[model samples]
Target: MQLNLTGHHIEITDSLRNYVDEKMERIERHFDKVTNTHVILTVENVRHKAEATVNMRGNNIFAESTEDNMYAAIDSLTDKLDRQVKKHKEKITDHHQKESIPLVDTEEE
Candidate 1:
Protein backbone atom coordinates (compact mmCIF):
# COMPACT_ATOMS: atom_id res chain seq x y z
CA MET A 1 0.00 0.00 0.00
CA GLN A 2 1.11 3.52 -0.75
CA LEU A 3 1.40 5.80 2.28
CA ASN A 4 1.30 9.54 1.75
CA LEU A 5 2.24 11.53 4.79
CA THR A 6 1.75 15.29 5.08
CA GLY A 7 2.70 17.68 7.81
CA HIS A 8 1.21 21.10 8.50
CA HIS A 9 2.96 23.46 10.85
CA ILE A 10 5.15 20.56 11.82
CA GLU A 11 8.17 19.03 10.23
CA ILE A 12 8.01 15.38 9.28
CA THR A 13 10.97 13.68 10.83
CA ASP A 14 12.48 10.30 10.08
CA SER A 15 11.66 8.90 13.52
CA LEU A 16 8.09 10.15 13.25
CA ARG A 17 7.76 8.58 9.83
CA ASN A 18 9.18 5.32 11.10
CA TYR A 19 6.79 5.31 14.03
CA VAL A 20 3.83 5.79 11.71
CA ASP A 21 5.05 3.03 9.43
CA GLU A 22 5.38 0.62 12.32
CA LYS A 23 1.90 1.38 13.59
CA MET A 24 0.45 1.08 10.09
CA GLU A 25 1.80 -2.45 9.90
CA ARG A 26 -0.95 -3.48 12.30
CA ILE A 27 -3.54 -2.32 9.80
CA GLU A 28 -1.94 -4.32 7.01
CA ARG A 29 -1.88 -7.39 9.19
CA HIS A 30 -5.62 -7.17 9.65
CA PHE A 31 -6.51 -6.27 6.08
CA ASP A 32 -4.04 -7.06 3.38
CA LYS A 33 -6.12 -5.63 0.57
CA VAL A 34 -5.54 -2.05 1.67
CA THR A 35 -4.75 -0.04 -1.46
CA ASN A 36 -3.38 3.16 -0.03
CA THR A 37 -3.37 5.51 2.92
CA HIS A 38 -3.18 9.27 3.29
CA VAL A 39 -1.98 10.57 6.64
CA ILE A 40 -1.99 14.19 7.74
CA LEU A 41 -0.36 15.62 10.83
CA THR A 42 -1.24 19.10 11.96
CA VAL A 43 -0.33 21.26 14.86
CA GLU A 44 -2.90 23.89 15.70
CA ASN A 45 -2.06 25.97 18.74
CA VAL A 46 -1.45 23.44 21.52
CA ARG A 47 -3.35 20.67 19.88
CA HIS A 48 -1.68 17.98 17.82
CA LYS A 49 -4.02 16.42 15.32
CA ALA A 50 -3.55 13.26 13.32
CA GLU A 51 -5.88 12.14 10.56
CA ALA A 52 -5.76 9.29 8.08
CA THR A 53 -7.82 7.99 5.22
CA VAL A 54 -7.48 4.38 4.15
CA ASN A 55 -8.53 3.13 0.77
CA MET A 56 -9.40 -0.54 0.72
CA ARG A 57 -10.94 -2.95 -1.71
CA GLY A 58 -14.52 -1.73 -1.48
CA ASN A 59 -14.41 0.84 1.29
CA ASN A 60 -12.80 4.04 2.44
CA ILE A 61 -12.06 4.43 6.16
CA PHE A 62 -11.23 7.72 7.85
CA ALA A 63 -10.17 8.50 11.39
CA GLU A 64 -8.87 11.54 13.21
CA SER A 65 -7.66 12.36 16.68
CA THR A 66 -6.49 15.41 18.54
CA GLU A 67 -4.27 15.33 21.60
CA ASP A 68 -1.73 17.34 23.46
CA ASN A 69 1.02 15.14 22.01
CA MET A 70 1.58 14.10 18.44
CA TYR A 71 2.39 10.51 19.30
CA ALA A 72 -0.75 10.18 21.35
CA ALA A 73 -2.80 11.60 18.51
CA ILE A 74 -1.31 9.08 16.09
CA ASP A 75 -2.02 6.23 18.50
CA SER A 76 -5.61 7.30 18.91
CA LEU A 77 -6.02 7.71 15.19
CA THR A 78 -4.76 4.20 14.57
CA ASP A 79 -7.11 2.72 17.15
CA LYS A 80 -10.10 4.34 15.49
CA LEU A 81 -8.97 3.18 12.06
CA ASP A 82 -8.47 -0.37 13.30
CA ARG A 83 -11.99 -0.51 14.66
CA GLN A 84 -13.42 0.74 11.39
CA VAL A 85 -11.49 -1.83 9.37
CA LYS A 86 -12.62 -4.69 11.59
CA LYS A 87 -16.23 -3.58 11.34
CA HIS A 88 -16.01 -3.29 7.58
CA LYS A 89 -14.45 -6.73 7.30
CA GLU A 90 -17.16 -8.26 9.44
CA LYS A 91 -19.87 -6.68 7.31
CA ILE A 92 -18.37 -8.12 4.15
CA THR A 93 -18.05 -11.59 5.60
CA ASP A 94 -21.56 -11.52 7.05
CA HIS A 95 -23.01 -10.39 3.73
CA HIS A 96 -21.37 -13.23 1.87
CA GLN A 97 -22.55 -15.80 4.40
CA LYS A 98 -26.12 -14.54 4.26
CA GLU A 99 -26.17 -14.61 0.49
CA SER A 100 -24.60 -18.01 0.15
CA ILE A 101 -27.13 -19.81 2.31
CA PRO A 102 -30.77 -19.77 1.26
CA LEU A 103 -33.53 -20.38 3.76
CA VAL A 104 -35.52 -23.54 3.26
CA ASP A 105 -39.31 -23.53 3.58
CA THR A 106 -41.27 -26.56 4.74
CA GLU A 107 -44.98 -26.84 3.95
CA GLU A 108 -47.43 -29.24 5.56
CA GLU A 109 -50.54 -30.37 3.72
Candidate 2:
Protein backbone atom coordinates (compact mmCIF):
# COMPACT_ATOMS: atom_id res chain seq x y z
CA MET A 1 0.00 0.00 0.00
CA GLN A 2 1.12 3.54 -0.70
CA LEU A 3 1.23 5.62 2.44
CA ASN A 4 1.17 9.42 2.31
CA LEU A 5 2.03 10.75 5.72
CA THR A 6 1.50 14.43 6.48
CA GLY A 7 1.90 16.57 9.54
CA HIS A 8 -0.22 19.61 10.22
CA HIS A 9 1.35 21.42 13.16
CA ILE A 10 3.99 18.82 13.92
CA GLU A 11 7.15 17.68 12.22
CA ILE A 12 7.32 14.31 10.56
CA THR A 13 10.23 12.49 12.14
CA ASP A 14 11.85 9.21 11.18
CA SER A 15 10.77 7.45 14.35
CA LEU A 16 7.25 8.70 13.84
CA ARG A 17 7.23 7.42 10.28
CA ASN A 18 8.57 4.05 11.38
CA TYR A 19 5.95 3.82 14.08
CA VAL A 20 3.17 4.50 11.59
CA ASP A 21 4.58 1.94 9.20
CA GLU A 22 4.71 -0.65 11.93
CA LYS A 23 1.13 -0.06 12.97
CA MET A 24 0.00 -0.15 9.35
CA GLU A 25 1.27 -3.70 9.01
CA ARG A 26 -1.53 -4.84 11.29
CA ILE A 27 -4.07 -3.31 8.96
CA GLU A 28 -2.44 -4.97 5.95
CA ARG A 29 -2.62 -8.32 7.64
CA HIS A 30 -6.39 -7.96 7.78
CA PHE A 31 -6.93 -6.57 4.25
CA ASP A 32 -4.47 -6.89 1.40
CA LYS A 33 -6.50 -5.10 -1.26
CA VAL A 34 -5.70 -1.68 0.05
CA THR A 35 -4.68 0.64 -2.80
CA ASN A 36 -3.52 3.71 -0.96
CA THR A 37 -3.53 5.21 2.50
CA HIS A 38 -3.39 8.86 3.51
CA VAL A 39 -2.36 9.58 7.08
CA ILE A 40 -2.57 13.00 8.66
CA LEU A 41 -1.13 13.98 12.02
CA THR A 42 -2.34 17.13 13.66
CA VAL A 43 -1.53 18.88 16.88
CA GLU A 44 -3.90 21.26 18.59
CA ASN A 45 -2.80 22.68 21.91
CA VAL A 46 -2.50 19.57 24.05
CA ARG A 47 -4.40 17.21 21.79
CA HIS A 48 -2.73 15.04 19.21
CA LYS A 49 -4.86 13.71 16.40
CA ALA A 50 -4.16 11.02 13.86
CA GLU A 51 -6.38 10.29 10.89
CA ALA A 52 -6.15 7.84 8.05
CA THR A 53 -8.11 7.09 4.88
CA VAL A 54 -7.77 3.71 3.29
CA ASN A 55 -8.66 3.36 -0.38
CA MET A 56 -9.57 -0.05 -1.55
CA ARG A 57 -11.02 -1.68 -4.63
CA GLY A 58 -14.72 -1.14 -3.87
CA ASN A 59 -14.71 0.89 -0.69
CA ASN A 60 -12.98 3.70 1.18
CA ILE A 61 -12.47 3.53 4.94
CA PHE A 62 -11.64 6.54 7.08
CA ALA A 63 -10.73 6.62 10.77
CA GLU A 64 -9.43 9.16 13.27
CA SER A 65 -8.30 9.27 16.87
CA THR A 66 -7.17 11.89 19.35
CA GLU A 67 -4.98 11.50 22.43
CA ASP A 68 -2.40 13.28 24.51
CA ASN A 69 0.42 11.37 22.81
CA MET A 70 1.05 11.07 19.10
CA TYR A 71 1.92 7.40 19.33
CA ALA A 72 -1.31 6.67 21.18
CA ALA A 73 -3.29 8.53 18.56
CA ILE A 74 -1.65 6.58 15.79
CA ASP A 75 -2.33 3.30 17.54
CA SER A 76 -5.96 4.13 18.08
CA LEU A 77 -6.41 5.29 14.50
CA THR A 78 -4.93 2.07 13.13
CA ASP A 79 -7.18 0.00 15.40
CA LYS A 80 -10.24 1.80 14.10
CA LEU A 81 -9.15 1.26 10.53
CA ASP A 82 -8.51 -2.42 11.22
CA ARG A 83 -12.06 -2.88 12.49
CA GLN A 84 -13.55 -1.05 9.51
CA VAL A 85 -11.59 -3.15 7.03
CA LYS A 86 -12.68 -6.34 8.74
CA LYS A 87 -16.31 -5.23 8.70
CA HIS A 88 -16.13 -4.29 5.06
CA LYS A 89 -14.50 -7.56 4.14
CA GLU A 90 -17.23 -9.45 5.94
CA LYS A 91 -19.94 -7.52 4.08
CA ILE A 92 -18.45 -8.27 0.69
CA THR A 93 -18.02 -11.93 1.43
CA ASP A 94 -21.51 -12.23 2.89
CA HIS A 95 -23.01 -10.70 -0.22
CA HIS A 96 -21.61 -13.53 -2.33
CA GLN A 97 -23.19 -16.13 -0.03
CA LYS A 98 -26.58 -14.47 -0.27
CA GLU A 99 -26.54 -14.60 -4.06
CA SER A 100 -25.06 -18.04 -4.37
CA ILE A 101 -28.36 -19.85 -4.29
CA PRO A 102 -31.50 -19.38 -6.34
CA LEU A 103 -35.00 -20.48 -5.40
CA VAL A 104 -37.49 -21.96 -7.81
CA ASP A 105 -40.94 -23.53 -7.51
CA THR A 106 -42.60 -26.27 -9.57
CA GLU A 107 -46.37 -26.63 -9.98
CA GLU A 108 -47.94 -30.00 -9.03
CA GLU A 109 -51.18 -31.35 -10.43
Tens-place lDDT digits, model 2, residues 1-109: 9999999999999999999999998988898999999999999999999999999989999999999999999999998999999999998885544444546665597
Tens-digit lDDT track of model 1 for 1-109: 8999999999999999999998898998899999999999999999999999999999999999999999999999999999999998888875543445547766688
> Against the hidden reference, what TM-scores do the models get?
0.86, 0.85
Instruction: Kindly report which residue pairs in candidate 1 clash with one another.
Output: none
The alpha-carbon root-mean-square deviation between model 1 and the true structure, to one decimal in Å, is 5.1
What ranges in model 2 sit over 4 Å off?
Answer: 94-109
